[model samples]
Target: MVEIVPYENCYLSGIVDMILSIQRDEFQIDITLDDQPDLLDIPAFYQKGSGNFWMALKGSEVIGTVSLLDIGGGKAALRKMFVKQSFRGAQRGVAGCLLKTLLTWSASIGISDVYLGTTTAFLAAHRFYEKNGFLEILETELPPSFPKMSVDTKFYRQMIKPSYVLPKRADLEGKK
Candidate 1:
């Protein structure tokens, strides 16, 4: 069984490890030690009225993570979303659960929109976001940390209103 919960101190190392693994295996990105953000940084951002973070777990294993970063005003950016490759298929539902939980939390805190930036290489991810009602938007300037390597990057945004509703059965059905 999978569980979505607030990040705990013990889960930090696992989260970082999984992120590093995904970067190495899937994205071919290398993150240096200084570039690594501490787990406390996540909650600290939220505590400072910046953003929120959560983790996904199966039993005692941390498999995925998502962050809702307050870009300013009432806007929040959905960033650093990832789930381990080994946990795909039905296990992928954990990601959706985490996203829904984050959206609910954002709504409670008055954030009315969420934005995301991803690379075109991740076609599956783009489709997943679309299935979840996120709209494709034009790409903005790449983040300073991102290598100027790709010109096919994409950006997406989703409005988060009190009335915003996810397709209940469709999301469960995993149809893109």
Candidate 2:
């Protein structure tokens, strides 16, 4: 059975491998792990303030990953969503599960809007986001704090109802 859980240090290697495989091998994106500094220090970059990362694992292997970075003002930027081809599509449900997990967490933690940037090559991703209520948006509409990747040519946004108070930075410190 596939299980979705918060990221842990022990799973870093597997998560990186899965992401690299999906990007380089499957999608043929000519990017390296070194280009993504956040992958090197997920705990510091994500998992702080309103940011978070998660993994979808089957047994000891990571099959998918996703992350949300808090850009302040009740807004977040979605990042690093990749799923192994074997676990993709409606039949497998990996991508949908990971997205739902992120959105649910965002709503519970007082996040009002979630934005994402993607490359033009991700046609399936565009359809996926649209089907899940994310509307196509212009880059200019993104928050100032939104991190725009060099390869990103498309943007999307989704509004949600936040249910709980957001945790303070101090509350998350030293708890990784």
Candidate 3:
């Protein structure tokens, strides 16, 4: 079984290793930990204000991650979404679980819009975002405070309704 939980100090190394491996090894993205300073201090970067990070763990092993960084004024930027290659796809549901957890937290904190930036290389991610109600958006559509990464050519936005419900199995059923 898998467990989805808030970021803990003990899992810092696990989270960094898992994400770096998937980004560099699995996706062949020519990036390093130096390029992602957030990984070095998850609590300082994401755990303040309305933002937070989560981990998908199977036993003590980190399998996936997602984070919501509150840009301010009930808006947020979704970041650091990565799942292990072997644990991906609908059957595995690791990605969905991480997303569900983030969305649920967003709703709880009165977050109105969740925005994300991704690279063109993640075609599967584009489809997944669309399936989950995130519409493709232009860079200009982003909020002034939205943190746009250099590699982020594709962007998406998902609006959270006032009466948000933790999505049914379809939104992320059988996840985790």
Candidate 4:
């Protein structure tokens, strides 16, 4: 069973491992730069209450994570969402659960909308966001930190409207 929990002491390493695994296994297109932030940096932001973060776990192992950085009152930005490949098939509902939990928590705190930036090369990621009701928005200039080596990229946004359907755990039932 998959469990979603707040980022706490023991889970930090698992989160780092999940991110490094994504950087190593999933991000092969670019070797000139590392896409992940330092693990230690995560807690500083969370500790400042500038953001909220969570981890998805099966038993004692963390398989995924997602975070929301509060941009301001009624606004937050989505960041660092990833799921491990070994845990990918039918059990992948954890990703949706993590997202729903974050959205619900954001709404409770008056976050009106969430924004995120991602690469066009991550087609599966784009599709995942679209399936979760995110709309693709044109971003003319890439973020300064984003690698300049790649010409292909995209940005997306999702308004946290009441009509948005936060996927239920059942939605991923039987999906492999």
Query: Candidate 3 regions off by >4 Å?
Result: 164-176
Would you list the C-alpha lDDT of every candidate in the order shown?
A: 0.73, 0.92, 0.92, 0.71
RMSD of 3: 7.3
Error of 2 at 111 (Å): 0.3
Give one digit per residue, the lDDT tens place, for model 4 in 1-176: 88998888778778877776675568754532244443567766653444788888889998888888776656667777788877654345877888898888776766677777776666777888889888887665323333222334677667775445567788778574
Q: Of models 1 and 4, which has the larger TM-score?
A: 1
Runs of candidate 2 with Cα error greater than 4 angstroms are 164-176
Could you tell me which residue pairs clash in candidate 1?
none
lDDT of 3 by residue, 1-176 (tens): 99999999999898899888878887788888999998999999999999999999999999999999999999999999988888989999999999999998888879999999999999999999999999999999999999998789999999987554567887586676
Backbone clash pairs in model 4 (N, Cα, C under 3 Å; residues 3+ apart or in different chains), count: 0
Clashing pairs in 4: none
RMSD of 1: 8.7
Q: TM-score of model 4 relative to the true fold? A: 0.76
Each prediction's TM-score versus the true structure? 0.78, 0.90, 0.90, 0.76
> What lDDT is obtained when candidate 4 is compared to the true structure?
0.71
- The lDDT of model 3 is 0.92
In model 1, which runs have C-alpha deviations exceeding 4 angstroms?
Answer: 38-40, 140-152, 163-176
Candidate 4 minimal-lDDT segment of 10 residues: 142-151
**Residue-by-residue lDDT tens digits, candidate 2, 4-28:** 9999999999988888887788778
